[model samples]
Target chain A: MPVNSTHYLFLSLLLFSIGIMGALMRRNAIIILMCIELMLNATNLLLVAFSKIYADADAQLFVFFIMVVAAAEVAVGLAIIVMMYRKVHSVDINILNRLKH
Target chain B: MAIYDILFWVLSAIAVGCALGVILSRNPVNSVMFLIITFFAISGHYVLMNAQFLAIVNVIVYAGAIMVLFLFVIMLMNLNADVEPQKGQLVQLAGVISGGVFFLVILAAIKSAKPELMDKTSTNIGLISDLGKVLFTKYVLPFEISSVLFLSAMIGAVVIGKKEETKPLTHNGEEE
Candidate 1:
């Protein structure tokens, strides 16, 4: 049996849900960032699958742009994380309460 | 089942399992390792979809570059399970419940929507050559704009991350 787009869609859904759970439950900022990456990857998978289903290249191009943005986002995000760590001496998100004051 | 179907099942299983591992691992380093595995598995799916260029880019950008950055930060932070305090059990339970609800709603939405399937004629759309044509001809503006975005991101990261050096002496060369 050939694989259908639904298979890929379901897989994306599962991965995305897991990423959401991790982002919500994790206290460490780094893990939360990683979870966000997971969510992005899930979207990429669904886009590529849809591109295949429709026999179109536009969605794949969109995936390419998403990857580019994700790369740039990761660079800046990790830099901010590093700076936060330097200030607080911890990677815990709960310790980020200084902004609330 | 055909080979492609088998590959899909196996790779999806690996990807989902690694995703779970990423969240559940106690050590942040372990979570990073699992995340790398998840990226590799997703790249495998890209290959099965005949997106060769994307598969290669996914491996290179995500597993190679981005994940290495994550690992370097993890090492620099020296994070462990013990150092990071856990949230309350109630909060953890609430998070899990909310995520589950979100997943169920999206799944239902996916099931309700019908996507028309096109005939498979080896479109070769996912090929690098074809993708380059469309990207350059049609999406050229966004492509160029993304480069500018990357440049700005680089400058911003450097500005934010750079350390400040304190000068001990005044301009008059006198220490207060």
Candidate 2:
């Protein structure tokens, strides 16, 4: 039997949930960023699956755009993280307390 | 089960397992490695979905470039479990619970909502030629706009990462 779209959707859901847990539970900034990447990957999986199910290429094109944005986001995000480490000497999110009055 | 179904099951299992590993690993470097594994597995799924272009791009962009960037930052910062402080157990528990609930809600919604299944006529839409045609014709505006977004991000990263110059101070009547 061929793989159904529901199977792909469920897989994406599980991956996304794992990402959410990681982002929430991990205090390290790098791990959190990695988790966010996981979530984005999950969405890309879902988009590809839907593109197949609909027999259309629109969703796949959207996936291409998502990848572009993700690359840009990673570049800027890692730079910000590096800056944060330089100032605070730590990568833990908890250490970023200077914003509080 | 058919060959494709079997492939789907195995790849999804690996993807989910690596995803769990990403969150559970104490070392940031290990987590980045797990994330790479997860990306590879997802690319496998893309192949099964007949998205050849996406599968290749996923491997090159995610597993290749992005994960390397993550690993480099982890090394630059010298991050490890010992250096990073952990959150309280209560917060961890709360995160787990919330994530579980969110998963359950989405799963339930998916089960209840029935999506129309299209006939398996052809898989040509996923080919590079078809995707390129669609991307350039209908989605040309967003495609061009994304290039601009990337340009801005590059400039922003440079500005943010540049070293700040320290001003020199002069003492009274002479430089100290």
Candidate 3:
């Protein structure tokens, strides 16, 4: 059997699931952020696959925009994490619950 | 044909395996390294798909810039496996089960819908010149708007990362 869009779809889905598991199982904020990036990359792979299959430039452009947004998100998220670390001295998410106090 | 198949399998395997390593690793720095590998593998997939521009941009932006930023943050905090935190076994099991169920559902749905999606024509739509033309001509407004978004993100990152001025900084030496 040759590689096809379905194969790419399956692979992307599997990667996405792994990212979700990582995000859910990790207590460290940085690790969860990495998992989110993994999920984004999974979707990017799928988008590129579809773009190739359909010969559509639009989807590829969308992927470019997605990368832009992901970059910005990571920047702000890491800054927030740094601030949180400065205050609470740990990147653990459980401490965020006490943020209201 | 065989080579294409082999390349796809190899790239996909690297992507998935490194992604697994990213989450499984106890150290933030290790996770960053694994994610970088995963991004590189994804970039290879882009190349295999003939999205050459995307492949290069993915490598430059993702593996080079973003992952390096992640690495710097990790190292800045001096994070190691000793300080790594993990969820309880029960919570982790539940998460895995949920993600597994979601994957199985999507797989079943896509398996039934696969054939209708295989016949689209391929073209040189992934070329840089073509993408640049579309980006500047058709998508010019959004392109410019993305710049504005980037500016805001830069400001936001700086603002959030900046030290509070409420507590005044004391000079360690006599002011000239």
Candidate 4:
């Protein structure tokens, strides 16, 4: 009995929930960012699972595009975090009250 | 159940557990580790789907490259275990309510989702040769565009990461 698409969907759901929990609960920007990545990966997994189940390459191709976007996101996001850390001396997102300006 | 079925269940459980750890862990480093485990588990899922190339790439990129960068930056920042501002009541309530709501919504959706019928001829192109052929023949344009996107991102990252010149002189410098 091979793993079915339903199993994949459940995994994606669980992963997405973790990401939501992290983004909501964590005060650290970096951990939140990691959670966001986890969420994106969950979606990608779902796409690949759907593709294979349908015998379609389009969704896998979409996953490829998603990976490219995720890579770019991390690069820019980390740079912003570094710059933010410079001014605040901390990566704790809760301390970012200066943004109220 | 067959061996693959057993492996699938075991791996799925580990993946779900690690994913939960990513959210529950207060330590950022520990969260990052949990995220790594999630990546590995997803890669295993790709393997179960017979997308061998995708599985390897998933592990190599997410678990290998991205995770290392995350760990390096976490260490470089020398972050303390100090609690952040507004860490008391409001955030906890928001976390619980939002997560619970989202989970309920998704669970409802999953319950109603129509089961997808598996392809009778899945053409298990688990081999690199077949996948390469399809990719080059049908998905050539997207592939090329993705490369260009990567190149631009590389340049963008460099520009963004460059240090700002806030001071005209350094400690040992003599400004003209």
Best by DockQ: 2
DockQ of candidate 3 is: 0.72
The list of candidate 3 runs beyond 4 A from truth reads A99-101, B116-122, B168-176
Ranking of all candidate structures by their DockQ, best first = 2, 1, 3, 4
Clashes of 2: 0
For all candidates, state DockQ relative to the true structure: 0.73, 0.73, 0.72, 0.57
The native-contact fraction of candidate 1 is 0.79
Each model's fnat? 0.79, 0.80, 0.74, 0.52
C-alpha lDDT score of every prediction, in listed order = 0.89, 0.87, 0.88, 0.80
lDDT of 1 by residue, B1-176 (tens): 37777888899999999999998888898998999999999999888888999999999999999999999988877774456788889998999999999999989988966655433566688889999999999999999999999999999999989985874677899753
* Model 2, span B93-140: residue lDDT tens: 999999999999999989865554533566888889999999889999
Give the lDDT of residue B172 in candidate 3: 69
- Candidate 1 residue runs with Cα over 4 Å from true position: B80-82, B115-120, B167-176
Q: Which stretches of candidate 4 lie over 4 Å from their true place?
A: A1-3, B80-86, B117-122, B168-176
Looking at candidate 2 chain B, the ten consecutive residues that score lowest on lDDT are: B167-176
TM-score of each: 0.93, 0.93, 0.93, 0.88
Candidate with better lDDT, 1 vs 4: 1
Query: Clash number for model 3?
Result: 0
